[model samples]
Target: MKRILIILVLVLICTQIKAQRPMDWAFKLNLKDYNVKYSLPKGFSHLDSMISSYCRSDWSELFQYSLINTEGDIAIRFLMIPITPKTAEQLEYRKRLFNLSELFPPNQNYLRTIYFQLEADTTNRIAYYPKAYAKKTFNVDVAGEYDRECKIVYKGKFYKSKVVFLHKEDRMDCFIHYFYEEGKEEKVRETIAKTRGMFRLR
Candidate 1:
């Protein structure tokens, strides 16, 4: 019985070790892993502030951008910006999605914001995450939920995602959205796990 228990413990440890993705990065290879020490790009504070204030939720601990390196001569940057709008006017201004079925034309990512509807005061509020998802097509991969309301997208070989939490408690009554990488089903599961823990639908 002692030997059997010991073997079981060993198996558990081995499984846990394999489950965690390694902390790794390479020169000009930003997607190797996630690094959060860096400050966000300029021109993003107002948007971030608006999101936090509108939702009345703290977003400093929310998902940050993961830099990815590329072989292309032109500069390519990639990161997920989570955001929400406080007012209807603000929400309308953030609609930045344009179609990119063509790549040879070299489409730059539309720096867009996905809004979440929530109840605040007598007025309804929309919140958003602020970060741009930009990158070269070959270097990174992106998948998003483009619907009537919520839009979610993640980029690159490593698993990094952006999401908006929608609940049926009060004001809004429509879309619920979550985004992830196209082929990265495993990573998407991990993202959902983290999402459920840190976010609230209501």
Candidate 2:
């Protein structure tokens, strides 16, 4: 009887660990002849209405994917812009300019010029990181490819963003991880970490 009870407890603990492990999904971001593969966390569903509402022509050109949680709040956004058909000199120029600093809009009027134009306003107040938080920077490694990262606060919520230019693919991919009303920062962090670990640029 004692041995059976020990085995049952061990099995229960193992099951809980497996349940907490992050799950991954692989997909493609394609534009004409350009295509890249990435592995990201699951449980997010596509928010089709965002494409029709928030997205405009210029925005649509670069917006590859928009996803949201059950509450209808966007949790992840994947943006890509192709830089092919350019001369070798142009590629080098863009690569130099494409970094974490360039990912965000100008701080002077970030909301009015960029966020408002793209996402607009939906009862959400715009809040930029103060000078201290603005200096916070991090890094992301996706299947060995590295990128500079930063955090931004929107509507009193936190988000992490990564921007990188793929030299081989000649494209720029911007990844934004949004923390919505879930109120679970640890879960969001784990998801971001897991997805970043599994990302593969093809």
Candidate 3:
């Protein structure tokens, strides 16, 4: 009976140790393609209609549309450029130059090197880091991260283009991402396939 009690206590200690460890994230390709599956989070409302209605969804319009999964701390947004084809019909999001500095004050040295604007599929990835909280930066780089753009080729006229982002943390390479285009299905498929196993996510 004494020996059995000791064995049970040892087993309990091992279980507690395993549970206390942080969960590690290694990027695995469970979902191979970026389909139209990720639209709205459950228990969330579509405010795109309101955004387009009250505040003209154009270049001049100062609004950024985004969706966040409360279950998981991931969010993606697009820069809505009113209903104009010229504004709406874009692959490269060059127009966003006007607003990069808007999110953070111009005086601070910010980074935008890892951004692209082909039909403007802008993505903002937020991942948590347990270590860096006590330091100056708190679980994030490129502070106040947000994006605004439109789905350029939803109709039959455009070639689909996709873009990716890597969060700048040495511990984990996780990134929040998005993509949209019209005719370049093969091109998009190839791009998605390549991203698999390349980056690790937290």
lDDT of 2 by residue, 59-82 (tens): 423334556665443366554444
Best by lDDT: 2
Residue-pair clashes per candidate: 15, 0, 15
* Ranking 2 against 3 by TM-score, winner: 2
Q: lDDT tens digits, residues 22-117, model 3?
A: 221100122122111232434333222123211112323222343333322222333311112342223124437444333311211122222323
Cα lDDT of model 1 by residue, 1-202, tens digit: 9999999999998875554323112212332222212233222211111111111142222332222222211111222322223433334344433343422111111112232222222122333322222112111122223222112222223222333322221122112233333454464455434433221211
Off by over 4 Å in 2: 1-32, 49-62, 70-74, 87-169, 197-199
For residue 99, model 3's alpha carbon misses the true position, in angstroms, by 29
lDDT of 1: 0.28
TM-score of 3: 0.21
Query: Model 2: which residue pairs collide?
Result: none
Note the Cα lDDT for every prediction shown.
0.28, 0.39, 0.31
TM-score (C-alpha, index-matched) for candidate 2: 0.38
Give the CA lDDT, 0 to 100, for residue 25 in model 2. 21
